[model samples]
Target: MKKKITLLFISFFILASCSNDEDSSIIPVAPVAPTAIHAVLNEGSVDITWTGVEGAGITYNVYRNAVKINKAPLTEAKFTDVLKNTGSFVYTVTANLDGAESTKGVVSEKVILELPKTKTMQSIDIYYDTKYEYAYTYDTSNITKLVSLTIKETNTDLTYKKVTVTNTVVKYTYAGNLITKMSYYSVDDIPRSSVENVYNAQKKMIGRIVKRSDGSINYTVTYKYNEDGTITETNDARDSGVGIYTFGKGNLVKYSITTPMREDEYLAVSNYVFDTKNEPTLNILGFNFFVNNSKNNEISSSTVITLNGELSSTESSKSDNTYNENGYVLTTMKTLKVSSGETLQTRQTVITYY
Candidate 1:
């Protein structure tokens, strides 16, 4: 009886030992912390990445500024945090395994502020050859208003003859961001000519009046718009002629001018072909402006005009524009087909940003 009892005890001890060994083998080990955490700053966001933990069923938890940001563990090794404003931030990542969290791996970054969507032009410098130039100045406090324009002339020859500098200064006034009046002056400070512009409630130009310095109206031009947001007609008081305009595909395709009494007498006619991305604005001139209107800033165009019902002229032009790192137009070169049957360099414009 004593031998049988001893044998039962030994069997029970062996069974208990085997059960403890199996439980020890099944116990999970905590995962190691992620290493080599890296952070990259982007416009209004931050991108973070780290070396993945080596184990089965492991995930990652992301923390920003020592606070847990993600509610659940991520299955991948990368994360992107969108910032509400421009500022500095810190991030850390930890490896998670079977409800166990490891130590964190850390990184820091700064979210740069985005620039304003629109910046009004502050100044313009026009180079009419090397000897003559026009420098336009604006009130930067109100970028929509141009204050003054000065014409400068350079003389390289040392001669006793006096250089006649006329119409050297011009003053401008604005009403609600629109040019309301402009007055030109000679070098002696005497007024030369003045122009007045009138606009409707929709900010569309309604009338333009040119006057001599003596305040006598020299000529007047009035404009009317169609329902589709295009200029339908213009009346010129100087020549007693009216111009009719027709548009196709949101572009001004043709225009013809005629006197009121003579319906068959067409003074002039012009037809234009625009690029796919043209936004016609009177603020700038040339087909290059149409191409510059594109997001890519590249364009080519052809135009034809008639005088007295005859094909008077044809022109072809192209423009190439380059941009700065901030996506602003840095420089542009325009080439035109001249009467000499060869391409001539017409204009070059450079822009500076604040």
Candidate 2:
């Protein structure tokens, strides 16, 4: 951290004699500097505060790396730089008077910019069932790599005899630039199943192997790319299923799954509509490596189920969102409904980036 100290400057008022050569009584006005300028990292932004210059009619002007960043002389000794990129930064502040900026003092602080690493998804179910929280650990040595993730879940239903809490931790293993596996464990130290990825000689992932806690094979999924650019997934487990994923404009637009339901095979189809804005959670490093809702913010989605090719049930959901200037989602209001038009529940989520 660097501090820019404003040195006291005395502007001498030159006393000049009139034609009579008599000295005019005059005094010099000294300009005061702010005590210090402090820039601290806060929630992926820079918070800058400076000790006020003790005087009336004096304001403050903030500078970043010698460039004035504020549009007007600030009445207060504080400024917040909402950063859009990361790098080393220097901040300075000086008092202002009569449209003139005072000299900046000599304390300097260097701030290293960090990528918006953490996103807290604080969600409240309008229907009150569960709450979810997640935090990710960044490999500080190489910040682009996400090392681990922790998830906290709470049972919010008061009808339950007692509420329960569960904690899950996920760790990632990578091979070069590709993510190879993700392992899961409980906070209490209980181990869970792990999923391993299978890649072809071309470094393209072709399948995934799920393993039991004891290292035995649980199930496997194979992937195939279609000529039309859609992808198909075959699951050897889970009632022997097949799924097709359709993509559009860098997002998954539709998905359909076929699985045996009792004696007949049922088909579940889902469709999604996305906004052009970038998804907020996807800003986290290494998150885009997963096959999921990462490319764009989801606006609306629907799912339909058919038993033996006959219509069964249908449901749809929509999201309303507010975003920061960088186009990252800051808040989302979600609503869900059934085919009968009965509202299921509403959910609100606020995301903070750190």
Candidate 3:
């Protein structure tokens, strides 16, 4: 009875297993392909927010008059066309995910921003100065702290330090306020540092920066000038980011550039330096990386430096610069430390300009 049951059941079990295997082998059909893309500008540029490609790590191409203007991978979802006098422009984004890419989405937008009026300065002058007074407790320690400061003009020369400190007194002097030919003095009345600088009448920078061991930094910028005194290029070596500057529009605009890291990095970090007041005189940045449960950003690892100012030799104070509405520096504010001691007070000097 058992043998008969086994033989009869074997065939049925085999057929059932085959049927299950066949069912498992059948794959579901893939979804339909994505639709073709057509991009158009909702405002002045293409707005890709409505499409599924928003912030999708997509690659895009911008075109004007059916000719490609830009083809680059976008870090953001938005892109602007700053090309001058683009009559008609179209922007399209292509969604690239995995190995497959979606069809191009296109948009056309019109832009109209009125350019501003320009001017040529007949003559421009910029300068500033600062003085410091220090008071120190000789019995406690040799450290001296600045108690008071006075601002002065760059043209005026500082004679002596009026404050008395424990053992040290510092004085500052000026040959010129151009930031390249300034001078400083010590307690013994010995000249310690000298700074040098060069600029055009508009104060556009074009020079090299040199720091000597005697505590002096010099600036000598070179510019390509027209016979009429209009500038072509203004280059400065004191900049950590910007290197070469190409001028346009009758000295109204400047292109400050950082020396290219590899000649290729120039394309992205290269930006326009407009002659507007919104331009920054200093920029200090830092970046860090961390691993697994550890905070990555660092603080002490970075050294800070001023972008467009002269430094004092003894205390390393950055000089102040004053700007007008036309974006030119009109005056400079500088401070010099004198002396600090237990018995004597500090002295300050203030200067005015025409």
Highest-TM-score candidate = 2
At residue 22, give the lDDT of candidate 3.
100
* lDDT tens digits by residue: candidate 2, 228-272: 987789988967888998988879899999888779969999999
Candidate 3 on 267-313: residue-level lDDT in tens?
21122222232111111000000000111111111112222333211
Candidate 2: misplaced stretches above 4 Å?
1-128, 201-203, 281-286
Residue pair clashes in candidate 1: none
Q: List the residue pairs that clash in candidate 2.
A: 1-109, 2-108, 2-109, 3-107, 5-105
Global local distance difference test of model 1: 0.60
Residue lDDT tens for model 1, 52-111:
989789999988878888777799999887654423467889998888898877564533
Q: What is the lDDT of residue 186 in candidate 3?
A: 49
Best by lDDT: 2
Estimate the TM-score of every prediction. 0.47, 0.65, 0.22
What TM-score number comes out for model 1?
0.47
Give the alpha-carbon lDDT of every model: 0.60, 0.74, 0.34
